[model samples]
Target: MVEPIGGASTGALVPPDDYFDVIKHICKKYDILLILDEVMTGMGRTGAMYAYEHWNIKADIIALSKGLTSGYFPVGAILTTDEIVDDMMEKGGFAHGHTLAGNPMGCAVALEVYNVIEDEGLVENSAKMGKLLIQGLNKLAKRYSIIGQVRGKGLLTAIEIVKPGTKKDIFPPEMDVNHLIADWAFKDGLILYPRRPINGLRGDHILIAPPLISDKAVIEELLELLDKTLARSMFMLG
Candidate 1:
């Protein structure tokens, strides 16, 4: 299984030149069943209709949620090839169904969400805004010693908080740096998702996923607020 965008678990964006494409090649070579968990990256959150589209590789099964209904209602879906469905049907008509599976209201809402996304060209907006967001974050990284790295694709992005001016250095766990930053940002009227360290027992990172429909001005405002929030948080930390 693979998370196309990596989300909160890893600040690393799946670049075309990186592991995602290589893993696709390997999975095909070995006839492995590839499952793409696109819960966070699906529905144009990553600039593409699906995050896998960025790699131009297909997965045997794809799971989608979150943006399926734009959080207007709780809904999710799994997509698979007809061959897979046929196999399941032959074995007993597929053995699973949710209590609210195929509810007309949810399906209708989801359909409207798709229509709105397409009509407003949200996917294209995500791509454009994403570039600006990354550029702004990189600039911030240069200015802030605590910002170790900035990485993202489309509206999905993250910044790693680290010890200032130290090589390969991360803030100690006891600092709760990520959570502190998030709390500060929230109190300042911005919300961010904090992630714990992927390596060792401690590290600090925060995920930033702005709405796909955000315009340049709104993004600029977000960055400005973030800048203030970071400065305040660092001051308190010190």
Candidate 2:
């Protein structure tokens, strides 16, 4: 089992270039079932409709949620190959002992949601805006010494924080440091997701995922607000 792209646990940590390729090769060699947890990286969040597409690999099982309903309704789904389904059916047909198994309302919402995502080209938008976001952050990193690293894909992205000229040297946790920029941005009407990815103790970073439909202008405004927020945080930390 894998996360494809590490989600909240690692703050959207994307693995090395060949990580998935290597995994797929190993799985094929060993004839092992590959499972992907796409709860956070699926449904166009990672710009490609599915993060696995970035590696062009196939998995035996894929779990999806969150974006499946776009927060309009609480729903989730699982996808698997016909081979697996046929095997399961032969072994007594499996059991579906959970609620919402086939709720017509949820099915309808999911259908409409899928159509909207396709019809509106939100997947392409996420890819487009994601590139703009990364480019903007790379430029901002040049100005802010506190921004140690910028990473992530599509609408799911994050920035690592560090003290000047040092890698992984974060501000004292007691200062509520990781969240300072988030708070500053909030006051300026922008929301940022702050997280402590290093053992959930000392390390600090902020996840920034704009709406899938955000345009270039919205991203520019976001970058400007983020610039101001970083400036305030640097001053306060210094």
Candidate 3:
């Protein structure tokens, strides 16, 4: 089956050239089709027109959602290379589609959203802000052992929480440290997304994804709220 192996959200990209190299290596070795999910990381969320552009790898197919209408409307789009399209057509259009596949209203809104991202320079702004956020988050990680890993590209990033004393002893099931921090951040006026697993036993991640319109001031505010919430949440110790 085909799946995306390497991608980034809005975050630091000091050496984007190297990151793409790893993605290329994996694609070659596995002989798998690279499907780029540009939902949160697309349409300038990464300061690039598309997150994959930063990696400089051409994707066989790209699934886009979320930012298409800038959250004003729900929409999705699929892009594929000419060869893939030809093959799919030869196979009877690939036999898949959604109810609103060609809804005019959604299309209109998505069109405008694309226009705005390009016209307002939001993509470039996201890239710049991503660097700032990565730097700040890295500092926070250094100060707090609760943080296990910080990685992302553009505006899409996640902070992994673990036990305070032992890196391997991640917060226990009863504690749900990811939810605790998410709740804490919400109470502090910074909304964050907590990753959830189907079994409710293996998920532990906090996603930091803000609107593309956010500026440095807003990003700083979010960072402060996140850092403070993480510091105060006691779930990690339990």
Best-matching candidate per lDDT: 2
Which of 1 and 3 is the better model by TM-score?
Answer: 1
lDDT per residue, candidate 1, 6-90, as tens digits? 8767764565566776887899799898999988999998899899888767789999889999988999999999988999899
Candidate number achieving the greatest TM-score relative to the actual structure: 2
- Local distance difference test values of all predictions, in order: 0.85, 0.88, 0.73
Q: For every candidate structure, what is the RMSD over all alpha carbons to the true structure, in angstroms?
A: 1.8, 1.3, 3.8
lDDT of candidate 3 over 1-118, digit per residue (tens): 2222223322222344576578778988988787777666678776687777765688888888878888888788888899988988998987876777878999999999878888
- Relative to the unseen true structure, what is the C-alpha lDDT of residue 48 in candidate 2, on a scale of 0 to 100? 87
lDDT of 3: 0.73
Among all windows of ten consecutive residues in candidate 1, which has the lowest summed lDDT? 196-205
Prediction-by-prediction clash tally: 0, 0, 9
Candidate 2 per-residue C-alpha lDDT over 1-238 given as tens digits, one digit per residue, 9 for 90 to 100: 9988878778778899899889988999999999999999999998988899988789899998888988788888889999999999999886766765778888889889899999999999999999999999999998888988998999899898888557568787777677877988999989999998666676588999888889999999999999999988878875
Candidate 2 local Cα displacement, residue 213, angstroms? 0.8
Q: Which ten contiguous residues of candidate 3 have the minimum total lDDT?
A: 4-13
Least accurate 10 contiguous residues by lDDT in model 2: 94-103
Candidate 2: regions farther than 4 A off? none
Q: In model 1, which runs have C-alpha deviations exceeding 4 angstroms?
A: 15-18, 197-201
